[model samples]
Target: MNTSAPDEGRIDTEVRGHLLLITINRPAKRNGFTPAMYRQLAAAYTRLDDEPALRVGVLMAAGDHFTAGLDLPTFAPLMQRGEQAAPAGGVEPTEPGMAGYRRRQKPVVVAVKGITYTLGIELMLAADVVVAADNCRFSQLEVKRGIMATGGATLRMAERAGAGNALLHLLTGDEFGAAEALRLNFVQKVVPPAQVEQETLQIAEQIAQQAPLAVVATRLNVLKAIEHGPLAAMEEFEATQQRLSRSEDAAEGVRSFVERRPAKFTGR
Candidate 1:
């Protein structure tokens, strides 16, 4: 595990086999994010995307709670100035409107517990998969703060769940529990607080075990379908398959199938 740029709050990154475990560390403040922390996290995301050895990312937090949301005292002025500054040469992990970098091609799984408010929920909503602890208390309370969810929540939440379901929470700024999160299709799994991280890690490991090219291609296709039309995404399937079929990993997949054994993919 490498702790990068320790400041008021920091983002800790660990490379576990092919999985990049990103932890938000600041238990005293319930892991709230400062501007420096956001830059650190963006750097970590950039690291994950640039490293060929890393295939998947698991985002979690240290301590009893996931996050209480942003440190308004630090971020409010920036918001007022209409300036969202990213790292000097790093990707923006949270929202595209916040930075100049492109979205990550790789997949990310998020694990949350206790208080997950405002931007915390937005972050989870932006991720590909979510594992929430039964003790989780989620709220998209930006409206209550005299602001709106500028993150992906406004765009993604309605698409994932129904608009009414998303609006119920987004509009009223009401708190919801894990059960409601599951019902709203906001979380993939709800486990005991003790098991949230382990469960999420297991899921990320499963993704990492697959052929790296195929995994990224699959995620990209899904995202393309969401951003563009399904027909547009489907139009690229033939080209994608033609490319993947020519890779060495594809040959290994055939051999492993013929041998009736688990494939040991080198991400070729």
Candidate 2:
């Protein structure tokens, strides 16, 4: 197992087998993200994508709350200057226009509890799956802060939760409970507060156990359809199939099925 800390320990990362466990550690502030913390968060996600051994990532917070969103005061200067910054070796935290801004090939499972606001919601939208605590409260309250959400919320929220639901919350900046989140399709599962992390890790572990290359390809195809329309995605189907068919793991998968045994994929 390997561990890494970034931005004065604001972000903590631990590797368990093929899963990268990332936790937001500053519960004292309700896990509120300072500009530095945002950079660290971006860096952690980047590490998850860059490391070949890491097949899945679990994002959770150490405290009751996932995050209180951006620390307005700490970020005020950057906001005023209209400057965007991401950590070294990291994708842009808010703006999706940056060259490095792209979704990860591997899956990410998020466990959210307590207050999840603004960027927190965007983070969940970015994740492949979300497990929210029953007590969780969420909002996209950037309009209340006299600013708009810079994260992908504007683009992805409506895609996940429908335009009407996304607009209702984004326009009103009202708080919504976990049940409403699930109803809106914002979260995949809602469990007891204490079970959030366990449930999220369980999902991550399942994804990690899959053939890594095939897993990535599956996610990529879905994203392609979302980003470039189904026709464009279909255009690449044969290419993807041919590529995966050539992988040794694919052959092992077939053999294992024929032998009535569990497949042991090397991610080759």
Candidate 3:
């Protein structure tokens, strides 16, 4: 449950019911990620995707801030050397496509507050859903550091927020508040700081309560639609529906509806 990386930072993981709660625990440095921390986080995500019992993942941070960004002093040299973000034998946390890391099959919900810069923004953008505190501050300051965001920010930001909105922050490297983030469609919900984690956990729990196969399939379909086009995703709808229809969970769903009781899905 307590997975520590090198340096003083660490990633703590806790499985609550069907949810994997991943907390970044390096508050002393505003939760800035070192290489080791990144690897540890990736390992946690790998567990979530590989474990059948784990239906959803909730990513949050300890202390006041989600993260300040990568430990640039340590990372910039690697960047200059033309090295990949994820080192050898480790999965890339932000962008799965980079370095051929296995794409995550599960959904991740992110809860953020205070200063969330650079990789923090990319992390949330890569996730399925996000909950932010009203006082949250976000910035894609990679350009300011004389580097570019390779952590799916350049690709997913425009997809999530419009091109204009994404460029406004990405190009300028200016700080934006939680309200602007909501307007840009970056975060799904904005609540008081005290309620951020609770709200995120509730949403993750809601997703976890659904049939796991259905949830995973739905996410895959939506992502495919985004990437390949709606028609392509729609073409697979019949086949996907038929597959689910044959599942034991589907039978349980029908029985529960007929019996006027809640469905108890075993992810079958």
Candidate 4:
């Protein structure tokens, strides 16, 4: 069950039932991600496509903070790594494995605690749902540190938190409290620090109990709807509806609905 990444022991991946629990293990560094950790995460996620048993996933960290953003030694190498990539259209991919990459299929959940910084919040944006502790602090201070917050938040955060809020946070690089994060809808919910992990897993278990294919399909369609216009989304949704209707799960769902019973789906 322990599929912890071998790179720096920064990531601990374990499958409990249908849920994959991913814990950032570098508590000493406040869970700051090194290059090895990032690559390991990407590598682990890549296997999800082939692993049919993984129905849900959660990302959390040991100790207080979820992450203090990228490690200095690790981040310095990102530039070097980015520079090494063959230039495509005179631009390198912003984040490793991001350009032309499909955001993951299964729902990805996160539990953010204290002192989330800069790219720390960006990782939450990548997740489908985020649960935060009441005292969690968030910021995009890369701009204040003489760098832009180009970790995809400059473009995506606006859609989630509105243009004004995005500008205020990213442009100013100011710290925001968890209460403000909840108000802006950055996090799905905020619980006491001690309850973050429990609450996140409670939600994760609910997610894992559902029909896997339906969850994945809904996640994919919903993200597309957010990125594309409603018309384009409608087209994709129609296509998806047609495909899913023929699945055995669709039939089981209808039968269960008519029978007033819970449906047991095989993820077909």
Candidate 5:
């Protein structure tokens, strides 16, 4: 643990090569987020956004369970005070019960294991890719708790898993195994518990090896397409290509790709 950057009891970050791995470390509590911890996630995402050295970021949890949900006890005070539209320092929490609202640009991969309830289930929708253990359970239990999903889930859940299934899960707040989640596109890949992290990291490593500028531009276009329409996304896509095609890195990518070598991108 780095005493220099102590972050209460929520997250632990380790930078591995060009990949930044942020683990929800309160596994003893099933990785629930404290209000302070919730606030830090957005700050961390902001750091990830500006860091040119990192091409990929990851969000995962330790132990068998991914997360039970927010630390209601710790955050209940904030709730009693009423949820602010955004966090005080402008780093706002991860969109209130939603995941993935704090970040975009770089591709993010989530590795899931064990039980995932509430925010944990919603979190998968936020990542570009998800690799999960076969044994993991997925659920949306906020309705059962007399709460609604405050995360991006309310919007993206139907898009991710089809409206029928999303309604079933959200309305009933039942738990289902990873096989169902995989079938519904909630997770991109499912493997044994032993290989989930390895596979996820490998996927991230491959993403990190691509041309940095092009990668981020691709992410932006894809996210724009998701939020807007294909026509609008296409407009940005053309401009992105036109802008990138003229850069030195563009030529380098082709040269290195043809030479079967790593492209030393200056991010030009």
Candidate 6:
């Protein structure tokens, strides 16, 4: 399905089976995100969560580069006014205190290539899994631009890439290659440029094939464990297990296992 945001057409959306394919379309500017672009991207993500048919989302770019980060010139006025930009039609991708506000109950995978700067890196970090092209270059250059990385980078970077490694790049605003990103755990996988999208889609498809409720529960459990403590996560274990056990999909799962056939989950 074609799900283009209302204005500018900066973000493109396509539905393939249960996967929502969201592509950054402003390649001419190396996918630099203007305010309109951010709104469109946020709208797509919100649609993914709101639509029950969409079990997973794959975020990739249309051009060689994933994104050049924010268009600082266009955003300078908002920054000067100390105002947070709001999305035009969807949930805000970043909240006041939450890190990675785009993280929905459903899973999201990201594929990146070429120059991924500032917000680009943060977007990757926000995703459940990342696939980076060999030619991908990443940098959190906000500090160099006399601004700080506010798009969940400060909160999520250390958690994903270790405090020392995150600071090394954040402090210096230096560019790093895909290999470095992999080593730092910034990216989950690295493939050739030609295969980045394919690989990402494959992973998203695999996740989409699973029972949607179980998949969402698993992701939520992990996030709860990370954001809260193990004790807090454990608190939900019994309740969640009991709830799922009574679900129709859970019964189907057991019956399918007994029949030695692939389970057809209905997201019950």
Best model per lDDT: 3
Residues 21-131, model 2: lDDT tens digits: 988877777787887777777887888888899999898887679988887888899989977657544655443555646556678899999999988888888888999
| lDDT rank order | 3, 1, 6, 2, 4, 5
TM-score of each: 0.95, 0.93, 0.95, 0.89, 0.89, 0.93
lDDT of 5 by residue, 1-268 (tens): 4423233466677889888887777766777777666666666666677788888888777777778877777766766776643445333334333232444567788899997877777666777789999989888888876778877667777887778878888899888998898888888898999999999999999988878888888887887787788888988866788999998999998999899988888777
Give me the runs in candidate 5 sitting further than 4 Å from their true place: 1-8, 84-103
Better of 1 and 2 by lDDT: 1
Error of 1 at 240 (Å): 0.4
User: What are the lDDT figures for the candidates, one per model?
Assistant: 0.87, 0.84, 0.89, 0.77, 0.76, 0.85
lDDT of 5 at 114: 90
The TM-score of predicted model 5 comes to 0.89
Task: lDDT for model 1, please.
Answer: 0.87
- Candidate 2, residue 26: Cα displacement in angstroms equals 0.9
Model 1, 122-201: lDDT tens digits are 88887889999999999998988898888778887898887888888889999999999999888999999989999999
- Candidate 3: list runs displaced more than 4 Å: 1-7, 85-91
Off by over 4 Å in 4: 1-9, 80-97
Q: In model 2, what lDDT does residue 219 have?
A: 90
Give the per-residue lDDT digits (tens) of candidate 4, residues 132-232: 99999898888766777766787767878899988999888888899999888889999999999999999998988777777888887787787777777
